[model samples]
Target: MHDFKSNPQFQKLQGKKVLVTGGAGFIGSNLCEALLDLGVLVVCLDNFATGHKHNIEEFLGNDRFTLIEGDIRNLETCQKACNGVDFVLHEAALGSVPRSINDPITTNEVNISGFLNMLVAARDNGVKRFIYAASSSTYGDSKELPKVEDRIGKPLSPYAITKYVNELYADIFHKTYGLDTIGLRYFNVFGPKQDPNGAYAAVIPLFIKKLMNHESPVINGDGSYSRDFTYIDNVILMNLLCLTTENQQALNQVYNTAVGDRTTLVQLTELIKKYLSGYDPAISKVEIVNGPNRRGDIPHSLASVEKAMEMLGYEATHSIDKGIDKAVKWYVENQHSF
Candidate 1:
């Protein structure tokens, strides 16, 4: 019953100094915006490897906002960003199943080595909290309806393995090094600024972009594969909850940050078409190619939010329908540039 839309942990951030690695990426940028809105001094670190400068361009002149263009793999850069920062939200990673499958070595280097560097830096700086973006892909190959944190299966892809490794290292850091860290297992997060032009684009924005161009969007599988599809606002709430929550029992743990619901790609497609009809009815008629099942694809993924609710006080406001509309509108406004 913990409410996220009007969060109490939010007030705990005012006057705090925060460093958000990968703060230029989609989720990271959204997080940076929220932190700044709370009157917190925000520092963003990114390599531009997969992040866009335009995402954080609006904050360039703000005194409270600082952008550090660097890779997290460099220990020195990590230390520099962590210096004098109160909370560190580490969101930097190569985030694509296909991309990781195509080049796992690069993924491992960034996700594993880079994560370790941040951990070392945060420990050195004595940061108050170390919150990172973990993925629900950690529930790989599990046939469960709703994924629970304590229970997990073998990682299906390199991306999944890398994320699971993050949780492992974080737990070790807490027990071995005495640094308080929390991991948020995000399930299919989508929203504004999610790059739709990339070869490995996420579903919502990529499909919206393709439909806007009057092109057929590929539906990687038979369209039956479902996801929890948490929205950016929900994710932003969870991140804030992790940063400021004082529940001693919740420390040194991971929470599944997602709406406890399911929507298949076909259902999502219909929802998008319905929403875009108001903007441009032509999008409703766009073609969708039903391709074969994708490699490393799971049939369904739903998160059991009982833990986040009981401990972290996470309450997801936007369901898939409402979240998709917001995402489609953002894509419609921005699709012209690319």
Candidate 2:
């Protein structure tokens, strides 16, 4: 979307064999698609615990795209997926603070143990780089505005703890095993193919689905809490930069992957309603109800994308408004798939 073909680093990605863990999930599926577009051979490893088969169904017929139905928790599965892969984009994990709180054991088993398995497999197989999906939740109770990479606070939730542990493990792997790694700490990412159904669905797609169905969407608080609502394409660009950057300073470091902007829940709902109304006028009148804020919910979250810009030449191609418009259009066109 950002003229990737023009970037020489991106040009180097062509014909490389890359393995994407959790390639059937929302973000992973999107990554797989972007890599395939650049003529990169993609091997997707997904257990489908949360990832949907429908997400990667389109790529099933592509010769360059291979999907391995396996779990990262199993060392052998990770080893098999990493075999002959040039790079690894690890996106598998149990996401959601509330869900992790409900079952910390499974979250730890997957996010921490599975992550370790992948790292060991990558190291054993001689993969050049391992780029992972880190979380802004790792910021935890830090009341910091525009979160920077070096500064972090104590984790608040089980999910947050697991993600923070990932950064630690990755750094250790680089220092001890010489496995080149980069962790992209993603903020509240949202866009097409993101699931809107489930107890732990993210706010954007969940709100979009509710508004489309003319159901009253609940706001967790007074709708004042905000997030650095990032578009999927922006995330894709960051992953490409992580995969292709030649700078030694950029490797084995964590960077925030966000647009350096924030939008309140109130503003987000208005934007969604405004866009969806074009497809169905009834969406304009969808009710928004306020509920008590849940435990461990951050009041506000933003990111400093300066590090990514300075180090990787990363630039966000879409603002929240533009991203919402595109996402709403997709949902409208494919509402029957839900």
Candidate 3:
């Protein structure tokens, strides 16, 4: 296995043509920025179904970047986006448990159908490698303290099932069609560019946005549920590392992309409150509104990144505290939009 950090193979993707599906969303935008910084030619595809255009507006003039406003649910769109692309980073999907619970068909239409569209497109286009956005929700009902790769429980929600299904289809595509693919099962990833004003936004960004606006954030399930919130930079590094590594053993596999540490909702709220106080001591007045248990919500989630460490030489540099500090600062500066 190639050491992800130490190997010279990291530079192999420097000038490659990379396609980032959903390149206008939080994670996809961040990934696109990283790729642009590395001198990679990036073709960003998004339908704006759930992604915002402002996310990629900053890169509009870059000679190395091209933005195609389209959806992956359409196979022709996926094929056109994959044409001449050297590698694929599939991050496009409709995400959120509550949203999925309310509208399972839309989630299925986008997540599963859209994912299949990209996989087939990448395969037919003869892309160098296919890397996709898998979810930690695949751990599902498995009561393991720190989730490992091979073991999983029944999916709790339609969203979870869609993500887990991505992994399954990706595996099948690789084995049956002789393709190379890697799945990064992200665990509550958060950082700059994360959307906070949405009805189904993720917790960290949402809470930070709420606190910045002097609003009391809800503490679902008494704020006891914990998570391993991974930072975007770490995710960017993992993707870059995985895309270039020549380890045959690492292909056709899924790896947990997280810091491998758990923080409870109460503790997370306290941390956010502490950071926000720097802006306005009065902002500290934001209190938790304890609510009924959320449907399809897991009690706790932490990842055992041993597989990533051993096979991909992946190491998380930021702790949950560090990620929160950075994310909170971004939300503070962009409070009005929230």
Candidate lDDT values, in order: 0.90, 0.94, 0.89
What RMSD, rounded to one decimal, does every model reach?
2.0, 0.9, 2.6
The sequence of per-residue lDDT tens digits that candidate 3 reaches over residues 1-338 is 11233446666778899999999999999888878877789999998877888889889999999999888888999999999999999999999999999999999999999999898999999998999999999999999889999999999999999999999999999989987999999999998888887688888888887887789999888788999988888898889978888789999999999999999999999999999898889888877898898999999999999999999888887888888888888887876654
Best by TM-score: 2
Per-residue alpha-carbon lDDT of model 2 for 151-175, expressed as tens digits?
Answer: 9999989999999999999999999
lDDT per residue, candidate 1, 1-338, as tens digits?
A: 12333555587778889999999999998988888888899999999998899999999999999999899889999999999999999999999999999999999999999999999999999998999999999999889788999999999999999999999999999999999999999999999889887788888888887777788888978898899999899998888888888898999999999999999999988888888878998888888898888899889999999999999877787999889888887877877655
Residue 116 miss distance in model 2 (angstroms): 0.2
TM-score of each: 0.97, 0.99, 0.96
lDDT of 2: 0.94
**Model 1 ranges off by over 4 Å:** 1-8
Candidate 1 vs candidate 3: which has greater lDDT?
1
